[model samples]
Target: MLSLIYARSLDYCIGKAGQVPWHLPDEFAHFKRTTRHHVVIMGRRTYEDHDTLLPDRVNIVVTTALAYRAAEGVLLAHSFEEALALARGADREIFVVGGVRLFERSFPLAQRVYETVVHTTVPDGDTFVPRFDFSGFRQEILERHPTDSRHAFSFEVSSYERVE
Candidate 1:
């Protein structure tokens, strides 16, 4: 199955200065747990922004840079189609991890989406997730996490499955 995962604010803000704007450990944990052992496809910028390649998963970084070099064990694709092809070869669930362009390209082909809605906004955010057509999917709220000492924001994790 092809799935997209992301946590965005009320205004669809996902990042600021190439990093997630808020620190919500629970949300991060949820993301880690869900995408672990799967094939994750992300754009070059998102791949670079992350401190290290996501562990225990097949990481495919989509980029147009022909000379771009990545760490060992990381796969590089020149386009979203190429990334999807590589992920499909792994025979595991495919998850589009981030960077707006990749999401925009993969959204229509995704069978499911795991979205965490953070109850706040980031006016200064420079990166945002693609706005999807939610009406075509059946929504289900999987978890609702509240603000705690370790988490600064309250968010709800929801699953969306394509109706057809």
Candidate 2:
């Protein structure tokens, strides 16, 4: 099963253009630590924005076209199915990360979601979180931290698991 992880502002917005404003070191560290040996899937745009091959993780980039060449430590797939195929033998959980179009396409296949809700809004955002109907899922508040000197807003780390 697929899993998603992302952070959204209070207004449910994830990015303004193609970037997240806040520093999410803690979140990144947690992800790296937990999914070090897993395959992480993301859209071409998300891969371009980050531009680095993460150590100890398999980076899979999904695109509609095969024009782009895969980097030394990265793999390219023309579709989600192909990406999953490339990750078939991996024994770790597959983590689907951002770029809204990718999230929309992959959400239904996701068994769980880890989200950080930032208690603030970006009035001029162009990207947003998917509207999830959580009727069949159980949500747990994993952690809540008040924003202080490092960030302008407080946020909560939450985990959602599908009941069925």
Candidate 3:
């Protein structure tokens, strides 16, 4: 099935200066645990931002630049369609975890969405998560994390499944 995952602030900010601005360890761990062993598709910047290929999953990096080079194990798809084509070969959930454009493009095709809402506003955000219409989906709260020393912002994880 096709899915997408992302965390955004109250103002819908996902990235600031090319990186996620929050330091929520629990949310990060939840992301890792959820997407593990599944196919993850991301934009070139998102893939490159990571130090290495995401272990234990098929990684497809979508890039408009035809000449772009990624790590040996990482597959490159020149278009979003190509990326989805490559991800379909795997019999696991295809998660688009990415920069803004990828999320916007994949929103319509997603059967599910794992969204983390961080209860804080990002004043200097450069990237924002695209607004999505959730009327067709049912939301279930998966988990909620309170603010603590390790995490500066309180957050809640919710799973939205399209109601057929």
Candidate 4:
């Protein structure tokens, strides 16, 4: 299965100054649990921002530069199609965990999307998650967590499957 896992704000902002502006450990944990042991494809920036190989999962970094070499256990792909091809061989859930470009490119091809809709917005971000119409997706609310001292914003983890 091809899945896109991400967290975005009310206005679809996903990043601020090349990074996620919020620090919600629960949401991060949810991300890890969802994509664990899967093939994760991400843009070079997102991979770099992560600063390490995601454990227990195949990390595929998409970059245009021919000289780009990732760390050990990381695969390099020049295009989104190439990444998907590599991921298909894994025979596991393929998760697109990205910067803006990768998410935009893979949205159409994804069979499922696990998204955390943060109940706030960051107007300064240059990276935004593309708006997806839920009409074509069967939406299910997996869980909703209220904000606390650790979590600054209230959010819900929603599962969306393509209605085919």
Worst 10 residues of 4 by lDDT: 126-135
What is the descending TM-score order? Answer: 1, 3, 4, 2
Regions of model 3 farther than 4 Å from truth? none
TM-score-better candidate, 1 vs 2: 1
Tens digit of per-residue lDDT, candidate 1, span 59-148:
999889999899889999998888988998999999998989888988899999999999999999999887788998999999999888
- Model 1 scores worst on lDDT over the 10 consecutive residues at 44-53
Encode model 4's per-residue lDDT on 89-116: one tens digit a residue. 8898899999778888888888899999
What is candidate 1's CA lDDT for residue 76?
Answer: 93
* Model 1 residue 106 CA deviation in Å: 0.6
lDDT of 3 by residue, 73-161 (tens): 98989989998998988778899998889999999998999999999999989999988899999999999889999998899999999
RMSD of each: 0.9, 1.6, 1.0, 1.1
Which 10 residues in a row give candidate 3 its minimum summed lDDT? 44-53
Predicted candidate 2 versus true structure: per-residue lDDT over 11-41, tens digit per residue: 8898766677567666656667656788898
Q: Which model is ahead, 3 or 4, in terms of lDDT? A: 3
TM-score of each: 0.97, 0.91, 0.96, 0.96
Backbone clashes, each candidate: 0, 0, 0, 0
Pairs that collide, model 4: none
lDDT of 3 at 23: 85
TM-score of model 1 vs. true structure: 0.97
User: Which pairs of residues have clashing backbones in candidate 1?
Assistant: none
Residue 145 in model 1: lDDT: 91
Candidate 3 local distance difference test against the native: 0.91
